[model samples]
Every structure is written in C-alpha cells, then in structure tokens.
Target: MDFGFTDEQKILRQTFKKFCEKELTREYVAWMDENCDFIPDELYKKLADLGLFGMIIPEEYGGSGMTFTDYMIAMEELSTASVAAGICAGLAVSFGAKVIGGMGNEEQRRFHLPKMAAGETKYCLALTEPGGGTDIINAMKTTAVKKGDNYVLNGQKVFISGGNVADYMLVVALTDPKAAKRTKAMSVFVVDAKTPGITVNLIKKVCIHACGTTEIFFEDVVVPAENMLGVENNGWNKLVDVLNPERIGTAMLSLGIAKAAYQAAHEYSLERYAFGKPIGSFMVLQHYLADMLIEIENATNLIYKCCYLMENGLPYHMEAAMAKIVAGRASEIAAIKGMEILGGYGVCMEYDLQRHFRDYKQMVFSPISDEMAKNMIAQWTGLPKSY
Candidate 1:
C-alpha cells in the first residue's frame, strides 16, 4: 500500500508549519500559555485567515470540506507549535464540520456553517458531567424537559474546553432517563452560550493553560426545538460520529506535543555541555532522545493510518482507540524524557521543554483516557468487558 501524504497534504503541512514558525515562536507560545486561558482574538483571527477554522467545512458553507486525513495532518502540524492553539482550532472545526455540517438539520446548517467557517463563531462541547466521564451516560444527572415549544435544560458540565469564550455550546443531556434502552435516553442541543440561566466558571489546570477548562451550570436554560440535532433521544448514534474523529484528533495532539518535546530535548542535548563535552556525547542521553524519536515516529504513523482509514470509509474505531493509547503514552514518555534530558532547565520557565513537559499530560485522560481506550480495545480484541 502506498504510504505518503498527497501533494496537497504536503503543501498544507508546509504552510501551517511555516505559520507556526513565524507566529508561534517558543517565547510567544509560552507567554500565551502563562497569561491567557483563552485564545487571543488577534491570533484566533489570524488562524481564521489561514483557513484553519474551516478546513473540514463544506465549500458551499465557505469551508474547504476536506477529508479527515487532511484535518489530522493540519492538527498534527499545528500542535507541534502550540497545542493550545491547535485545540482552539480543533473544537471549532469539529463543531462546524461534524455537528452542523454532517448532523445538523438544513436550517441549522444554513445558520451556523457559514459563520463558523468564517470564524465569526466559536464552539465548545458539554458532554462530561460531575458524576462521570467514561460512564457518563449512565451517570448523567443533567435533564431536559420539553416545555411548550422549547426544551428547558437543567444540568452541570465539567471539563468543558473553551466554554467561557465560545459563542455556542453543543450540550448532551438526558431527555428520558427512564427509557428502556439507556443508550436512547439522551439527546443533544445546540444552545446559545449567552442564553439566559447559563452560568460558566473556569477551572484552573496545570497544563494547556492557554485554553481554559470550565464547569458550566445550566439552570433552566431554554432552547428552541429546532436546535436539537438529529433525532430526539438518539444522540448516542450521532455522538459516536463526533467522538471517533475526536479520538483520532487526540492522537494527533499527542504526536504534536511529542514532536515539540523531542525537538527541544535534541537541540538542548547538542548545545548543553557537561564533563567537558556536549551532553550529546553521553550514551544515556543519546538513548533517551533516540527512544523518544522512535516513539514519536511510531505513534505518528499509527495516527495517520487511523485517519486514513476513517477518511476512506474503513472501520477505524479500534484503530482510533489504539492510536490514542499509543500516541498518549508516547507523548507522556517524550515529555518525561525531555525533562530528564534538559535536567534542571526542563522545569524553568525560560525553557520550552518545561511547557512541553507540563502540557503533554492532558491527553493521558482527556477526550478519552488511555485506560478507557484500553478497556474498549480489549473488548474489540475478543476480551470480555472490563469496565
């Protein structure tokens, strides 16, 4: 089988890599991470100008309507420079392309797609709750009741990325907690973030500080019936479509962080001197960097292949889970080894490695934890359900 980026994909990568080199210098990225919890408006606008916020949107909606592989390619490249920046783009792109473009009704599509494509709108997803993550559906306490012509929602969502800054939120809630089939008891709503009774509070975290995580409270928020996505009480069917891509995207995030960490550690090893010579001369340091590169390359290949399978209409869930698991571990290892290689400098604010060291950790449990991925993978491989 041929294994290479298409000419267009290569150009896409080069263009984005250039953008990162020019606008996302290490110092600047670190500054944003230190001082901001949301993407700066100017930088967000620049990303829009670069077409990152609309790559997967249909051309008719003013988007490129690109393939999943292309989205992954851009994600991996963007994350290499700054994962927080990449995440801001990722959430918007997925909401526009997947939710509105693929699952939204015609009116919803017409209303949201063009604005999202132009970066005139931003989005956040509220799926996880205070009670659970992997088992969120069964543990969900958020409820939505039909009222006249609208759905009145009352619930809380935690770990909502970019919620405070988003123009809209895709909320998952229980519409029929007593439904015989638990999977069909829930539905999704696209709600205005400024809707009355919606309260947002930011959650402080140690990594990826540039993109704030949040806990949101919806106290009888009213949403029109037209805003419900897909068939009512069948959000699980639709959510799967949104989530598989997110898993693959998470893998790309890990690979990007690994790439950044590896570069920092490699450069530092050659420049930092100890025992009258460069640290590069030490065999142990060489092994650390070498292993790190191997993990990054291996994880990258797996991630890309998963994206390709998804783009080509092949079964990709198992592979997506595996990719997330492999890439997350790879990134965690690369970050730790990066810190080890940089020694004390790894923890210092002036060194990018420290950011890499701190930031590579979120993926270990986000989107889907590595442990959760393993649980699903085990079942896929003919093992009994373990979780």
Candidate 2:
C-alpha cells in the first residue's frame, strides 16, 4: 500500500500550518494559558469558518465531510502551534459533530450537527467519573433510569474536557445495572449542558489551561428518551468504536508537541554558543538531538500506520494503542531533552519549551495512560490481562 499523503491532504496540512502560523502566535498562547479560560469566541468562529470544526462531519450537516486521516492532519498542525487550541477544535469536531453524524437518530443529527458543524455550539464527551479512568466498564457509577418518556440521570463526571463551555455532552451511564455483562448494561445519552440539576465546575489544570477541563454533577437531571444515542445498552460498543480514532488523534497531538519541542531544541542548539562554540558542535548535545529525531520519526511512522489502517477500514485498535504510546513517550522525551538543551531558559515562563514540557507530561497520561496502552497491546497478543 502507498504510504504517502494524498495531494489534497498535503495541501490541507500546509494550509492549516499557515493558519496556525498567522493566528496562533506565542503571545496569544501564553495569554490563554495564563488566563486559563475557554477559547475566545472570535477565534473559535474563525476556526469554524475554515471548516476545521467539521472535518469529520458530513457536508449535508453543514460540515466538510473529511476523513479521519484528514482530521488528524489538521489536529497535528493546530497542536504544533498550541495544544490547547488543537484540543478545543478537535473536541468540537470529533466528539461533537462526528458522533452525532455517526450514531444519532436522524432528528438528533439534523438538530445538533448543523449547529455543531457551524461552531454555533460546542460539545464534550462526559465518560470519566471520579472513580474511573481506565477501568471505565467496571468502575462507571453513573446511572440513568427510564421514567415516563424520560430518563432521570444522577451521576458525576470528572476531567471532562471543555465541559464548562460545551453546550452539549455525550454522557455514558448505566441503564441495566443487573445485566450479566457490564458492557451491555451501559448506555449513552445526549444531555443539554443547561439542563436542570446539572452543575459544571471548572478544574484548574497545570497544562493545556485554555481547554477548561471540568467536573460535572448531575443531580436528578432529566433527559428525554429521544436523546438516547443508538439502542439502549449499546453505548459500550459505540464508545469502543470512537476510542480507536480518538487514540489516533491523541497520537497526532503528541507527535505535534514532540516535533515542536525537537525543532525548538535543534534551532536553539545551532544558534546558542557555549564556551565560544555553538552547542551543536558539542557531542553530547548532538547525541540528544539525534535521539530526539529518531524517536520523532518512529512515532510518526507508527501514527501513519494507524491512520492508514483507519482509512482502509482495517482493525486498528492495537495499532492505535501502539501509536499513542510511542507518540506520548516520544513527546515526553523531546520535552525533557528540549529543556535540557535550553538550560535555565527552559523553565522560564517567557519560553514556550516549558509549556511544551508541562503539556507533554499531562498528555502522556491522558486519553489513555502509557501503562494502559501496554496492557492493551498485551491483551491483543493473547496474553493474560495485566491490569
């Protein structure tokens, strides 16, 4: 199989790169990080105008109807400029319009897709609870009981990215607690963020500050039965379908952050003189740069392989997990090496490397942790479960 980006994909990547260069300046990123708030409306609108908000959404729903690979390209470019911006835009498209397009009923799609595709509304996935992260199927505590034409929800979701600003959320809750299989007991619902008995509280974070991660409390919140996505008790399968793609996207974001850090370190090494000689001339510094490049290239290859599998409709869960782990580890290494190359300047707020360093640390643990990824790979190979 050909392992090259299509001409259209290449052009799209370049276009997005140019957009980031023009709009996502270091000063703007710094300001947003320091403010620790949602992305500005104007900037979000601009991204929508570029059709970034509809990369995976269908054209009929006012979206661009692009492939997941195309969406990954956009995510990488946007994240290279600022991880927070990349995440905000990525969440709107992937978890927002794409989910509705893929799983929602016709009416639900018609009502939500257009506004989400146009960036008039924002959406987030609310799956993780305070007690559950990777142990989602077993540890999920959220429950929704069917009432007269409605489902009453009472649960808590923590570490929900963009929860505070999102207009809608895809909530995962248990609908059949007594089902023999935990996976079959779970269901998914689309809930309005402003629904009564819902409370959202922003959680201050040390990295990706502009993304506005939050904890949401649902105290006897009522949702219409019509809002259920797919068949009841099928949310687990639907969630699994999305996880592979989301993991691939996470890999791309990690790759971007690593590449950014590597580029900075390489450029700084070439220009900065130490002991009357450029740091590039030092063997130790050269080795660090070499290791970073090798890791970045390896991560990129794995990500491309996973993307190709996705584009070809091949089973990609294993590849996606591998890609995420490789990319996240590479980013972690690049961040640390970048800081070492920068010396004291690396830790200063005035420099962007420190931000990359902090962000990569968080990225390594999110979406799925490195240990979890390893466990998945092991299980895929027919090995005994390790966690």
Candidate 3:
C-alpha cells in the first residue's frame, strides 16, 4: 500500500509547518524554558485562530471536523516545534475534545466542545494515583459515590498533566468494588476545576518544565449525573478504547523530540571541526548519525502504521503497543547520540538538546512502560514476550 500523502494532506502539513516556524520558533521555546511557564496566552489564542483545537472535532460541533490522519499531521508539525507546546494543545483537542465529543450528550457537547475547540478551556486526565503507577486497574483508590442527585468524589490524583491550569478534568473512579474482577468497575466523570472541595497542587518535575503537572484532591467534590461519560460501573471500555489514539499521539511526540535532537546533532557535527576537518567527517560521528536516522525512521513507520490500521478499522492493539514501546527507546537513543555530538554543550539549558534530552526521557515512561507493551504483544501474538 502507498503511504504517501495526498495533495490535500501535503498542503495541510505545509500550512501547519509554516505556522510552527512563524509562531513556535527555537527562541520562543527557549524563553518558555527559562520562565518555566505554560504556552503564552497569545500563542494559545493564535492556535485557536488556526482552528488547531478543532482539528479533530466534527464541524457540526463547531469544529473543523477533520480526520485523525489530519490531526496526526498537525501533531507532528507542532511536536517538531516543541513537545510541551504541541502536547499542551494536542491533548486538549484529541483526548479532551474528541473523547467528550464522541460520548458527551448534545447539551454537554454544545457547551463544552466549542469552548474547548476555541481554546477557551483546557482539560486534564486524572487516572494515576499516588499509590497506583502502572497497576492502574487494581490500584485505583479514588472513589465517586452516588449521593442523592450528585456523585461525591473523594480521592487524589498525582502527576496529572495540565492539571494545574486545566478548566475541566476527566477523572476515572470505581463505581462498584465487587463486579470489578474482570476489568475493574470504573467510570469517567467531568468536573469543573472551580468546583468546591477540589484542590490542584503543582508538581515539581525535572522535565516538561513548561507544562504544569499537579496533584489533585477531591474531598466530597460533587459531580452531577449529566457529567458521566459512560455507563455506571462500565467505564473500563471507554478508558481502554481511548488508549490506542493516546498512545499514537505519545509515540508521535517521542518522534518529534528525537527529530529535534537529530537536527541539533547533525548541525553540531558539521560545524565543530577537529584535527584537519569537521567532526562530521569522522567515521565515528558518521556512524552515530546513521544510527540515529535508522531509529527515527523505524519508529516513525511503526507509529504511522498503527494509526493507519486503527483508522481503517483493524485489530491494532499489539501494533500500537509496539510503536509506543519502540519509540521510547528511539527517543532515548537519539537524545544520547545528539548529546554525544554536542559533548558538554548538549547538557546546557541554552541549547535545545538538553531540554530535548530531558523531555524525551520522560516520554519513555508515560502512557505505559516497555515491559508492559511486550507483555501485551506476547499475549496477542503468542510470541512469548519477556522483559
């Protein structure tokens, strides 16, 4: 099958790439890193003007109504600019707007979709707890108890991306403890960040410094029944079904970070001369550059194929898992090679390679781990997956 972009897709990529070059330049990323701030308000507004937040939403819902492939194009371009900036926008559009648009009621969609797509609101997912890191199914401690006409939620969510500044939250909670044996009885609820008894505490981290990670506390926080995304005690399917797209987005993010590192390394080798010629002329440096290219291409192909299969309605769980797993390693390899090219300069914050290195490492652990992905592949492909 031909994996080439159509004329329209090509134009879309060109448009988004130009936008990134114009708005999200290397200097802009440096400023953000220095300040330790989220993407500026004006930048977010510019993205809204571009209809970026609506990239994947349906036109009927006041969105551009584009396909996942189109959204992937946008994701890649924005990510190539800055992973923090791109994800700050992409997650709000895909996991936040797309998830809500797909399942929310008409009233819910009418009110939330337009604002989200317009960049007036942002969202965060509250799935991981302090105690439950990877064993999310059996380790969830958050509870949303039905009381009268509202559900009173009581729990804490840690390492919540976009939590500190998000206007809305998609919280996963258990509805029943007994029937959770098979898949775990969990449900998703949308809660406004301003709701009473809800607290957002910022989390200090080494990477994604521009993005806000937080610990959220729900102490008798009330959520109306209208806000439930799926059936009571049946939210596991909703959560799991959404993982494919999320994982794809993350793998793409990793690819972007790798590309950033590759560019830095490539440029450094060319300019840094040693002995009688540039370091890039040396065989050892040439070997590293070749290895970096191979890793990037392999990861990129896997990620695209997974997305293509999912869009075409195929069983692609194993493929998606593999893409995410491999891409994480690819990211680390690129960053390490890039740093080697820069030597000590790569570790300094003034250059993009240091931030890229820190950012790529974080991407390696998120959504899922490499060992977990191998286990899933083993179960599905009968290949005896082992760590």
Candidate 4:
C-alpha cells in the first residue's frame, strides 16, 4: 500500500491549509467564540464552494467524491484553524451525507444527498439521550411505533450537534421490543425539523461553542415510514457502520486540536524570553516540544491508517477505535502541556490554546469515550472487556 498522499491529495491539503490561514484565522475564530453564535452562513457557503461539505459523497449525488484520506486531511486543517469549524464540517461531510449515501434507498439518496451536498440541508445524528450516554446500544430508550405509513416517535435526544439548526435529523429508536439482543430491533428514521411534535432546545455547552448542540424532545413526532433507513429493525448494524467512520473523523478532531495547541506553545516558547534567552532554547522546553511532536505524528499516522481502512472497505472497527483512543489521549496531553508552557495565559480564552484545550476535552467524551474504545479493543483481542 502506498504510504504517501497522491499529488492531487497533496494539492487539496495545501488548498485547505491556505483557506484556513486566510479565512479561518484566529481573529475570526475569536469573534465567534466571543459572540457564541453558529458559523456564518457565508463561511458555510465558502466551504461548500471548496467542496468541503460533500468531500465524501459521489458525484452523482452532487459531491466531489473524494477519498476518506482527503476528508481526514481537510478535517485536520479545518480543526487547525478552528476546532468548532472542524467539528461542523467533519459531521456534515463524513456522517450527514453518508447516512443517505450508504443506507438510504435510491429515491432517498436522489432526494437528500444533493441538497446535503449543496449545503442546503445540514444533517445531525440524533442517537444520544440524557440517560443513554455511552450505553447507546442496548440502553437506548427511544421508541418508534408503526402508524399506518408513518412512524410515531417518542423520545428525547441530548448533546446533539446541529440539533437546533439542522434541516433534518437522523434519529435512532427501538422498533421491535422482542427482537434478540444485538440484532434487528433498532431502527433509524429521518425526521424533518419542522415536524409538529418535535421540540429543540439549545443546550449551553462549555466548548466547541461555534457548533450548535441541543436537546430534542420527540413527542409522537410523525416520520414517514418511507423515511426509515435500511430495514425497519436492522438499525443496530447501520448505526455501527455509520459510527466507525464517525470515530475516524473524531480522531481527526483530536489530531487537529493537538497540532493547533502545539503550534501555539511552540510559537510562544520562541518569542517569550526567560533568563536572557528564548524559552525554547532551554533543554527542558525542547524535550517537551519534541515529545508533543512525536505524539502528534504517531496519533496522526494511526488516524490516516483507520481512514484508509474505512475507504478501502477493510475490516477496521478495532483499528478505528484504537485510533480514536490514541488521538484523544494524545490531544488532551498535548493541550495540557501547551497550557503548562503558556503558564497563566494558557487558560485565558483570548488565546487559542485554551479553546483547543476545552474542545479537545469535549472530543474525548464524544462519539465514543476512551474507556469505551479500550473496551472495544479488548473485545477485539478476544479478552474480557470492561470499561
């Protein structure tokens, strides 16, 4: 297998890097943080112009049809610019259109993917509940009952990014109560945001502020039965399939935050004087920077491996889980080290390091926790697993 990016991919990466530097600079990022608002519509359109929103969807569905590696690189660059921007684009590019491309029927794909690719409809994955944190599999309490040609859904979802602003939501609910464990009992439905019984409340979050996270209550929300993705009761498998890539994207978020924090620390070390010399001249500072670089490279390599496996249709659940675990831990540690190097200024939100630190911490708890990833790795190794 080739270890280097293709020439086209390299160009794409450079283009994204330039876009971040020119448009998603620290000053713009600070403006969003201070205002606590969603990314501007104009910027989202700019990303669409760059084909960032549809990086993975097929050209037939209005996407540029790039490989997973391209998508991951773009995610890293976007995160490097703004962690919240990375999360937003990552979810839209990696998961939003994917739900339709992978599981939706031809009619669904034709109807939905084009709009999603065109940035007309932002999609949010609605699987997490207040009570169903990491226990997303067997612990999901949302229920969807059949009603003629539509499904009546009753449940509440929490911690859903894009929940408030999305035009549509992919909701996971139990459809068959008596089905066997780990089988065709769960179902996924595409619910329109304007559905009468659905209520979305904006959730105040500590980090990743530019992205919207909200709590949604579905009280007998009517979703067309035709909107059910895949088979009615086989959503469990579909959920896992969708999430495998999501984890890889989350890894990119971690890698980006780590890289951003390291850059902040490195620049500060060189500019700040201590004992009549730049702090970066100190041996201890050099060691810390060296360690951060090593961790970033190792974790980034693992992320690329997982993305490649996913793109090639290789067996990759364990690999993706491991990548996320490593990236999350490495990013958190790197952010902490950056903070240490920056001293009192690190925690101040005026600096990008603190924002990255908060955002990276949130990444550790999402998609799948480090604890959950470890448990998955243990199970894959044929060992008893506990989190």
Candidate 5:
C-alpha cells in the first residue's frame, strides 16, 4: 500500500536525474542519434563507474544488490533525458549481469560478474531469430550440438541490441530437438564474441540509433561446456527471470520517454504565444496536455507497482504485461501529442521532441508487442488462446 520511496531510493532517483541532466542533454543525445550506432566506450565506462551497471547484480558478486524498484527509478530518470541511455543501461544490468547472477554458477559469477560490474565486459542477449521474434520457443531453430570438448552452435539471432560490441553474448539454442516440446530442450550459453564463425551484421533502425541493433550468425561457433548457464535442457524456465525484468525495464523506459515529451511540450506551450495568448491557455491544447499527464501518471503507477511486486518476490507475470501494454500506449500518445503541439518544429531533426517520438515507438513492439502483451493477459485470465 505504500506509495512513497525510501530515503535510499530517493537518493537513487536524484543521483540518476542529476547525472542525466548533466550528461544526456538534448543536444548531446541528438548528436549521438545522428552519428553513432552505439554508446561510446568512454561514456559506457563512466556509467559503469556510477554504479548503474551493478544495481541488479548481487553483492556477493561485486554488485550493489539493489531492489528492482531502484532499478526502475534509475530507468525512469535516465530515460527522461534519453531513452537510448535508459535502454543501454537496462541491457547491461537486466539482461547481461542478471544472466550470470541469476542463472550462472559460482565460477561463472566469480569470473564474469565483477568484470560486468566494472564495465570491463559488455553483454548482449541473443534470443530472437529470423522467424522466432514472438513465438520464440516454438519457432526456435538454433541448435547446439555436443562435441568432443565443446558445444558447436549453428543458428541465427535477430534484433539483438549491442550485439556488435558485446564482450560476451548469452545465446539460446536447442540442445534436444527431438524432445516432445521445444520448451523442454532449450539451453543458454555465454559465448565469447570473438569465437570463430560468429558474425554480427548491423541492422539499420530509425529509432534509438545510439543503442545499436543487429542480427548475429553462428556457424560452428564452438563454446566450452563450462560456459553453459543453468542446467542443460532447462533454459526455458530460467529465461523467464531475464524476460520479466526486461518487460518492467521497458515499461520504465516508456514512462521516461512520456515524461520527456510531455515536459518539452509543456514548456513550449507556456512560452509560445498565439492569438494574443499562450497556446497553453487554449482549452483544446490544455485538454491534450491534461490527458497526456493523466496517461503518464497511470502508466507510472502501474510500472512502480510491477517494481514492488518484483521486489517482494511475488508473481508479476500479469502485472508486467499490463504495465507494458499501458506504458507503451501512454508513451506513444505523449510523443504524438508533443509532435502535434510542436507543429512544424516537431518533425525537424533540430528539436528533441521528434527524437522522443521516434525512439518511443520501439517500445510498442519490443520486449513484446502491445498486442502480444494483451494476448498474454488474455491467457493469464483463462481466456482461450486467440493465436
């Protein structure tokens, strides 16, 4: 029932907000969006120094061991400055570090977690494939076969963020294709990016340019047996931990984008005079802003609620889906509304509102599409499967 943050949590929020305000200004990120396909190494190292990369990792593994709420707070603040920052940071912590902390064994943790926390290592999760974007388990075609002393992998993974720059990649593949169910035989491997026969091809994306997306190909890429995460043929159950955090993080990023767009439009409305008065003074524009605020608040509440449920170790599958669906729509509306208010200026690359509009659209389809999220909700509520 508590709606307030603890002192430590408040400090976390302030720290990231201050950091974003200083480092992720509109001019800086707009430049990055135009020129770079990934966050520069220096900036990535700086974020690692700020302890952002260690939030989800356990203290035993050289991390801060913070709660998921703290992670959500950090996401919201960083996203307010730029969704790319939020996404990159989230990818490092939620998808990368957690893969080792939650699923990897002691040796793996001791070897990988410290470097991950220190930003000495970067990671990408390679799960999505050419035809398996949504119906991942059933459509998975990647295979890893046992060799004399290694597992030789042959498959492809698409839409992987930071795939080109990662020091390591957590890959999912079928270890037993003959199993009764595809979900029963999947396995996860932490493969070195330099492994032989691995190729990363950059995919041109219009949004979140700084975060980099790519498709990875593995042809006889040999991975050591020791690099396997969790038990053999049990990755499907364990992967949910990573997937759930990803959804919540995605929702938090959506909230941040919504806030950013709304803030930009709000400032413009008060200052831009029209017909002898501020445009904000007009009831129609005011109503749009009001609606934007309402949706933003609603999404914020649900995302934080998901954070709470996660921190408490409760089942959050349904809540995460709902949060994802609501937050995605809220961010989309805010971006569109901000664009409408800014008029001709919004479409120009000179303004940050357009960046928000473009970057925020990715949330609608990523992690899981809103339509897919709703379908998950339908199943959770005992409805017949629609697809």
Candidate 6:
C-alpha cells in the first residue's frame, strides 16, 4: 500500500487548511453558531468561488471532478475549522448533488448539477419522519400518489438538516404500499422548497446550530413526474448507494473535530500552569494527549481506507460503517479528554473546546448510531441480525 497522499493531494490539503484559517475565523464561526441561521449567502458564494462545493462533481457539470479521497482531505481541513461549515459545503456537493449525478437522467443532470455546483441552488435530503429515526426505511409515513403527470406528496419529515433554506429536497416516500417487500414500496422525488403546502420549521439544537436542522411538513405538494430519481420503488437501493459516501464523509468530519480538540488541549497544556509548572509536564496529562493522538491516527487511517475503496469503486459499506463507528467514538473520547484537561475552561462558551465537545457528542448518535454500526458488522460477519 502506498499509504501516502500524492503531492497534488498534499497541496490541496494545505490550500484548504489555509482557506479555513483565513476565512473560517473564530469570530465568524461564533457569529453563525449564535445566530443559528442558514449559512450566509456571501459565505456560500465564497466557498463556491473557491471550488469547495464541487469536488465530487464532474467537470462537465461545472465541478472539479475530484476523487473521493481529495474530497475527504478537504472535508477534514474545513471541518477542523468548523464542523457546521464543513457539513454545509460537503453535503451540498456529495449527498445533495450526488443523487442527480448518479441516478438522474441526462436532462436532469444538465438542469441541476451546474447550478448546484455553483452553489446557486442548495439541496437537502428528507428521509427521516416522526418516530422513524434509524428505522426510517420501515417506519416511513410519507406517501406520494402518482397523478396524471405529477406526484402529490403528503406527510412530514423531522430532523432534516438544511431543510429550512434548501432550494429543493430529495424526498423519499411510499409509492407502492402493497408491495410484498417494504423496500419495494418506496420512491424518491425532488420537490421544490417553495411548493404549496410545504412547511419548514427550524429545530434548535445545542450544537452545530448553524447547519439548520428542521421539521418539514408536506400537504398535497405537487411534483412533476420528471423529478423522480432512478426507477420507481427502487428508492431504497438508491439510498443505500448514497449512504456509503455520506457515512465516510461523516467519519472524516468527526476526525477533523477530534484533531481540533486535540490541538486545543495540547496547546493549553503547554501554556497553562498549575503549582508553578506547565500542565504538559504532568505524566497523567501527557498520557491523555498521547491517547488522543492515537485515537485521531486510527480514525484518520480508517477514513482514508474508506475513501480509497470508494474512489476505486470497491465495496465499502461494511468499511464505511466501521469507520463511522470508530471515528465517532474517537471524536467523543478526544473531546471528553480535552475537556478534562481544560477543566473549567472546557465548559465555558468562551473556549472553542466546549463547542467541540457538544458537536462531537451529537455526532456519536448520528449518521447511523454506534449500535446500528455494530449490528451491521455482525450481519456481515455471518451472525444473526440484531435490531
């Protein structure tokens, strides 16, 4: 195994890190976190101009057509500065534009990809409904009935990220309720955000507030038949296709957050003194930093392995799940250790470590929980399915 970034990849990583350091300053991140609003148009446009939102898109569609590994490098750097900003940029390109790129008809791609790549349009995925959570595929309550040329959609989706300001949403709904299999009963459709009878209410959270999670209600919203992605009743498979990349992206984001927390704690240990001695001089504190470093290294390796598999068109579902579980827990552990090192400063909003702790805590339960990930591994290992 090469086990090293290419020269170009190294350059790209440094470039993005510099961009984050310059643009994603603490003041800007603090302002957005406090406001809890959608990412500002100016900031989105700046990211677009920097080509941050088009890494995975093909050049023909106004993107850079970069590999998944390149995208991961960018995600880690951006997320190190701010997880909320990283998610906004990464999702806009990956989960947001990827479905259309992979499943949409030629005309659909022509219509959506360029604008999405340019950040002129923002997209969100609506899959989880009230009480669905991780059981979304089976507990989905949304329904879409095909009419003459359009599908009338009804039902509600909760905890949808970017829903409030998204220009459009890729919505999954039950279209064949009587199908023998639950997976065969669902379909995916693109619905305009401004369509009639659609309501979006922002859900406030203790972390990553600027990402704009919301509850979206749909009542008789009409969507053109052409808006359907892939084959009817195959939305489940399409969902599976998109999830590997999303999970890997989530892992990279967690790794970034862990790195940030580790850096903060390391710097504080060197500078902060107790009993007329630097905290870094304590053997116990040294061990904590060492553990944090090891966790970050392990998570980074797993994430890069997933990225490599994805870029090379290899099967990565199991690996992605593993990466998510490892990275998520690693980030949580790093944050907790970092907090312990900082003591009172860790809980104070004045220090960024508190935000890292909060955000990493939330990540532990999202993008597939640790329990679900272990269950997947068990199934893949020829064990009985659990949950």
lDDT of 6 by residue, 186-297 (tens): 9988889999999999887888887988999999999999999989999888777866688888888899889989999999999999999999999999999999999899
- List candidate 2 stretches off by more than 4 Å: none
Please provide TM-scores, in order, for all candidate models, with all chains considered together.
0.98, 0.97, 0.96, 0.97, 0.98, 0.98
lDDT of 3 by residue, 154-212 (tens): 99999898888889999998878567373658888989999999998988887877877
Q: Write the per-residue lDDT of candidate 2 for residues 1-387, one digit (tens) a residue.
A: 677898999999999999988988879888888885778888899998888887788788777788878888888899888888888887887687657777888999989988887889999999999997989888899999999999999989999999989889999999998899998999989999999999999987778888888999999999999999999998898877865578888888888889889988999998899899999899998899889889899988888888778778888899888888889988899999999999999999998899899889777878888898898899999999887
Which runs in model 6 stand beyond 4 Å of their true positions? none
Q: Give all candidates' CA lDDT scores.
A: 0.88, 0.88, 0.84, 0.85, 0.89, 0.87
For candidate 1, the per-residue lDDT at 158 reads 98
The segments of candidate 5 whose C-alpha lies over 4 angstroms from its true place after superposition are: none
Clashing pairs in 2: none
> Model 1 segments beyond 4 Å from truth?
none
Write the residue-wise lDDT of candidate 4 on 1-387 in tens digits.
778998898998999999999998789998887775468788888888888888788999888888888888888889878888887776677667877678889999999888878877888889898886788776778899998998999989999997877888999999997787745789988889899999999988778889889999999898999999999899879768766688888888888888888999999999899899998998988888888898898888899888777767788888888888888877887898898888888988778888877788788878877887788788889887664
**Number of the predicted model whose lDDT against the real structure is largest:** 5
Q: Which pairs clash in the backbone of model 1? A: none
Give lDDT: candidate 4, residue 341: 86
Worst 10 residues of 4 by lDDT: 90-99
lDDT for 176 in candidate 5 is 96
TM-score of 5: 0.98
Question: lDDT at 351 for candidate 1?
Answer: 88
